[model samples]
Every structure is written in structure tokens, then in C-alpha cells.
Target: MSVIGKMLTLLRGSARELGESVVDANATRIYEQEIIDARNAILKAKSELTGVMAKEMQSAREIERIRAEALRLEDLALEALGKGKEALAEEVAVKIAETEQQLEEQSRVHADYALQVGKLKDLIKSAEAKVREHEREVAIARTTESVYKATRSISDNIGASGSKLLNARESLDRIKRRHEELADRMAAAESLDKETGTRALEIKLAEAGIGGDAERARRVMERIRARKTDAEGQ
Candidate 1:
């Protein structure tokens, strides 16, 4: 294809894709709206069917009236014949024939109306059932979509928390390592002080004859001697 033709084709394809995307995003809402439309259509059809049924009833009533009139005419004709009025009976017979013909026509009309009503009722019933089925499917789809979204959100939150937890663990490890290092340093400092400064002080005191078991024993002997001297003076 030429460049311009290819461009047009690409544009059309893009448009179609965009339309499909929009449709997919609003699929549940669209599905619900379609069901509503179907229900409305069924309601309208039912209304029409009601009208047809009314016509059928009217036709049936008309047929009944005609049959009643025909029966009355037959009775009148029999009475005239019993009374020897041949001409009057013949006139009544003509009317009976006309009434019967009208009854036939009205019956046909009633039959047609009845047939139409039956077919319409069946169609409406089928349509309603189909719409109901579609509605159920839409409900299922919506629930599934909601659950999927909730699950995905939970998964994302867990992923984020996992990262934060890892960071926290690393921070704790660093803090522990620092504390351990500080404790080791403190221990080393105490050991050095005991080894160097404390030993030096001990040596100094010992050279002055003031910090040993021998010095303690000498002090004790002097105190005992002083006490004995005081006792003699008393």
C-alpha cells in the first residue's frame, strides 16, 4: 500500500483498539445496561401482547353473542313452523344463516389473535430468561474482577512490606554490629586499665610498705601492744 493508505489503515486500527479498550474497561456497566434494555423490550412486548389478548377476548365475546342470536333465531323458526307460518320460519332461517357466518368470521379473528398472543408470550418468556442468564454472568464477572483487584492490591502491599522489612532487618543488623563492637572496645579498655594502671598502683604501694599482708600484720601487732600498755597504767 501507499504511505497515505498505510497511514489511514494504521489510524483505523488504532481507533478500533482504543474503542475495544474503552469497551473492556466498562464491560460490566455495559453488560448491565444491555440487560436493562432487554427488560424494557420485554416489558414493551408484554404490553403489546396484552393489547392482542384483549382483542382476542373481544372477538370471542362477539362470537358468543352471534351464537346466542343464531340459537334464538332457530327457536323462533321452530315456533313459526309449529304455528304453520312457513314464510316467517324461512325469514328466521335466513337470519340464522347470516348470524352463523358472522360467528365463523369472528372465530377466525379470535383464533388469529390467540395465536399471536401465544407466540408473543413465548418470545417474551424466552427473552426474559436469556436476559436473566446474562445478568447472572455479569454479576459473576463483576465479583471476580473485584476479588482479583483486592488480591492484587494485597500482593502489592505485601511486596512493599517485604522490602521495608528487609531494610529494617539490615538496619537492626548494623545496629547490633555497632553495639557488639562498642562492647568489645569497652572490655578491651577495662582489661588494659587493670593490667597497666592497677598493677602500677599496687607496685608503688608495696614499695612504700603500705599495701601487703605483712603490713596488715605489723599494724595489728602495734595496736595489741598499745592496748597492753594502757591496761598496765590503769
Candidate 2:
């Protein structure tokens, strides 16, 4: 491939990887937000279902009222016929027919609305179940994500602490070596203290004002001599 083509290909690959990383980082938040949106949808559906149910209830009452009116009209028509009033009976018959027709029509509408209510309720119930399942799954996902992040953090710490650990180990070894060297020197000093000529050497070294002042040692020696002289004189 040409250099330009290769560069373009590399750029595309980099972009794709970047996009994927961005998506992965935000995936949990996106999923949580999506669950929230779904819950909102459920609420909206429930609201709509409530409206449908209310309308269904109104339709039921309407059907009941229509049936009652039709029964009253039937009784009026029968009474008028029994009274030997032909014109009145005819008018009551017309009213009865109209009422019956309306009752039939309203009955059909009421049944349709009843069916609709049932279907909506079932649909809402199913949606609610699905939402609950998603909620559980999202919770699991979140927990799993947390665990993964924690593990990743620990791994990163362990990896990055390599240099610090190495340095600390080297420091400890150096301290141990130094301690051993100091122990050897202390042992040598003790050995020197046991030597036959070491006391005369230490006196000379002390008189040179190395570890303590020669003037202080002379003053201490003078006090001891004076006490001896006083005892001898007594």
C-alpha cells in the first residue's frame, strides 16, 4: 500500500478504537439512563391505560342507563296498548324501537371498550415485568462493573509499584550490610579492648583529646592523688 493509504488506514483504526473506548467508559451510565427511560415509558403507558379504563367505565354506565331507558319505554308501550289508545301506542312503540336500537349500539361499544381495557392491562403488566427484569440485569451489570474496576485498579497499582518495591528492597539490603559492617567493627573494638597493650594505646589516644578531654582526665587524676595524700598524712 502507498504511505498515504497506510496513514489513512491507521487514522481510521485509531478513531475506531477511541470511539469504542469512549462508548465503553460511558456504557454503564448509558444503560442506567436507558432503564430510567424505560420506567418513564411504563409510567406513560400506565397513564394512558388509566384513561382507557376510565372511558371503559363510563361506557359501562352508559350501557346500563340505555338498557334501563329501553325497559321503561317497553313498559310504556305495553301500557298504552292495553288502554285501547291506538295513536298513543304507536308513538310509544316508536320510542321503544329507538331506545332498543340505541341500547344495542351502546352495548357493542361497551364490549369493545372492555376488550380494549383488558388488552391494555395485559400489555402494561408484561411491560412492567420486562422492566423489572432489566432493572435486575442492570444492577448486576453495575456490580460487575464495579468489581472489574476495582480489580483493574489493584492490577495497575501492583504493576506501577514495581520500581518502588525494587528500590525498597535494595535499600533494605544496604541497611542490612551496613548493620553487619557496624557489628564487625564493634566486635573488633571489643577484641582490641582485651589486648595486652591496648590500655596504654587507649590512654595515649585519650591524652590526645580524641574521645574525651585530656584536661578533664588530669583533673580527675589530681583529685584521686590528693585523697591518697590526705589519707597518708592522717
The model with the greatest TM-score is: 1
Candidate number of the best lDDT: 1
Q: Relative to the unseen true structure, what is the C-alpha lDDT of residue 81 in candidate 1, on a scale of 0 to 100?
A: 100
Worst 10-residue lDDT window, candidate 2 = 16-25
- Candidate 2 wrongly placed segments (more than 4 Å): 1-30, 159-234
Give the per-residue lDDT of model 1 (tens digit) for 13-114. Answer: 754444323223466678788898889989999999989988998998898888889888999999999999999999999888888888888988998999
Error of 1 at 17 (Å): 20
Please write out the lDDT profile of model 2 over residues 28-142, one tens digit for every residue: 5776677777778778878888888888899889888988887887788789889988899899888878888888888888888788878877877877776676566556545
The number of clashing residue pairs in model 1 is 0
Per-model lDDT: 0.79, 0.73
Model 2, position 219: C-alpha lDDT score: 84
My TM-score estimates for the predictions, one after another, are: 0.57, 0.54
